[model samples]
Target: MAPNVLSIAGTDPSGGAGIQADLKAFSANGAYGMSVITALVAQTTTGVVRVQEVAPDFVTDQLVTLLDDVRVDAVKIGMLANAEIIRAVVEVLDRYSPRHVVLDPVMVAKSGDRLLAPEAVGALREQLLPRVDLITPNLPEAADLLGEPEITDVEQMPAQAERLSALGAKQVLLKGGHFDGGDSVDLLHGDGVSEFLGSERVETTNDHGTGCTLSAAIAALRPQRSGWPEAVREAKLYLTEALRASERLEVGRGHGPVHHFHTWW
Candidate 1:
């Protein structure tokens, strides 16, 4: 049977990011996909217009009810909008103890809109980081979590990744996508070891949901793979291919989306 992967995230009515992209990535990677929405975002390939956060109690109810019936093999956590929702999620995670948890620290949108509340950063860094099996943070998100300036040099990534791991994340995948480079690089630090995962940078503006897709793909592949290293490696390869094929999609005018189903369509 395919592993059951659940995405706890916000909604992207545009079908390019958030819950939509997560489900697509999960299914494309051969996992059974499910979702529990955290926010309803008025967004498109161009930008986020407005956001309506779900109530914390309701979010908790959704988790509890779903976990009560479904055997969730893995979970991919995205945009939890505020501190209360973060705490609510932590409580349930501690209770059920899902086998695998991959957190994509979604702090900002591809269009430069803030997704996570500023006050909630402390809650996410101090409370939620320690609980997850893996954390995937892009350069800015990692800097935000550490209360430091965004890293500009690739050489600085290892140290920054180490600092993020010190915050209690079992594993940290520090993404270096923002920097100008021939190859997009990410550092995976865990268990006192670090490995650099790199792929030729695909030149495309249609990369709106790359982070969400990569982390969800990792969660989807984790159950079938041997360990974090294997899962991340395969996931990066998948994202690279998706990016390479993104131009085939004509979703919207701005930063579109990677072709999650490139294998088929």
Candidate 2:
């Protein structure tokens, strides 16, 4: 049976990131996808223009209503617009602990637009960080979470991953994509393990939604694979292929989306 994976996130009507990318990645990785929308974002492949947040109570209603019936095997969390919504999500997570939760700290977009609010950072770090199974944060997001400067070197990743793990996430995948390198590397730490996962960098302008896609793929593959390491390895391979095949798609003028259906289409 395919795992029933839920994506709690904001929207990207352009279909490159957020809930759109999540659902695509979920299905591509062999999971049945579900969604609870947290925000209505007016965005294109180029940038986010406007964001209208869903009410906090309604967000709770969406989660409770869905979890009451469906058997959710894993969850991928993306852009929660504010602290109120984060608290609402945390409350429901406590009530019905999903088997696996992957948090992609979506602080900024590919176009350099800020998605998460400044005030909500503290709420996410203090309240929600401890509740998730794995958190996938790129260098900038990790620095923001820890209130430290962004790391410039790969050697700095392990210590940062460890610090993030100490915040109570069972595991942390600290991404090194921002660094200039031949390979995109990530440090996975926690559960008494520290390993670096790397892939050959595919140079392309159409690399939008990589974070959302990667995290969603991990959530989708987690229940089927043996463990986090296996799931992450497979997911990274999927994203790399997607990046390599992105030029096959011509979506928007700016950083376009990765090809989620690279294997099929």
Candidate 3:
């Protein structure tokens, strides 16, 4: 049976990220996609201009209603606006107990507008990190989680990944896209063991929604029971190809989304 993957995140109207991206990623892997909206964002490739959070009770209701019925194979969590919402998600996880969980700690957008609250960071690490099978954090988010300002060198990523594990995460994927170089290297760090995944960074300003896409892909495919490192590595390759295929399709004035339908069109 194909895996059923659930995504809990806000909606991005542009269809480039958030629930839309999650769904696209889900479909790319031929898995069923389920979603619970945490909030709604007024956003574009430029930045997030406004956000209206979903009611905490409503969020809980959606989760409970879904979990009580379907047998979710995997769960991918993104963009819970506040600590209360985070707590609500944790409660549901504890109750239903999905076999595979992927957490993409989406703190800020690629354009630098905050997607998660600074005050809620502690709740995320303390309450939610331990529940997940893998937590995907880019450099800035990793720094915030580790309480450090700089993770400039690629060599330091293993230590930071260890720090994330110490904070209750079973495994962490420290994305190295923001690092300076022609090549992109992502560190899959867990138990103080590090595996590096790399690709020649695509030369395009249209990269958007990559984190959401990659994590959702993993969640959708994970119940094949692949290891975390293998899942991440495969998803990275898929995302890179999507990036290359979408480089020329500048749909918007700002950063554009990946060509998720490249296989078809």
**What lDDT is reached at residue 222 by model 3?**
79
Give the total clashing residue pairs for model 1.
0
Query: What's the CA error at residue 64 for candidate 1, in Å?
Result: 0.5
Q: After superposition, how far is residue 56 of candidate 3 from its true place, in Å?
A: 1.1
Q: How many residue pairs clash in each candidate?
A: 0, 0, 0
lDDT of 3 at 208: 83
RMSD of each: 0.6, 0.6, 1.2
Model 3, span 1-265: residue lDDT tens: 8888899999888888999999999989778999999989999888889989998889999999998899899999999999999999999889888888999998988788898999999999899999998999989889988788968889998888888999888888889999989999998888657899998898887688988998998887777755877788778888888898986576777888987767777
lDDT of 2: 0.95
- The prediction achieving the highest lDDT against the true structure is 1
The digit string of per-residue lDDT tens for model 1 on 1-265 reads 9999999999998788999999999999999999999999999999999999999999999999999999999999999999999999999999999988999999999999999999999999999999999999999999999999999988999999999989999999999998897999899999999998888999989899999999999999999899999999999999999999998889989999999999998
Off by more than 4 A, model 2 = none
Per-model TM-score versus the true fold: 0.99, 0.99, 0.97
Q: How close is candidate 2 to the true structure, as a TM-score?
A: 0.99
Give lDDT for model 3.
Answer: 0.88
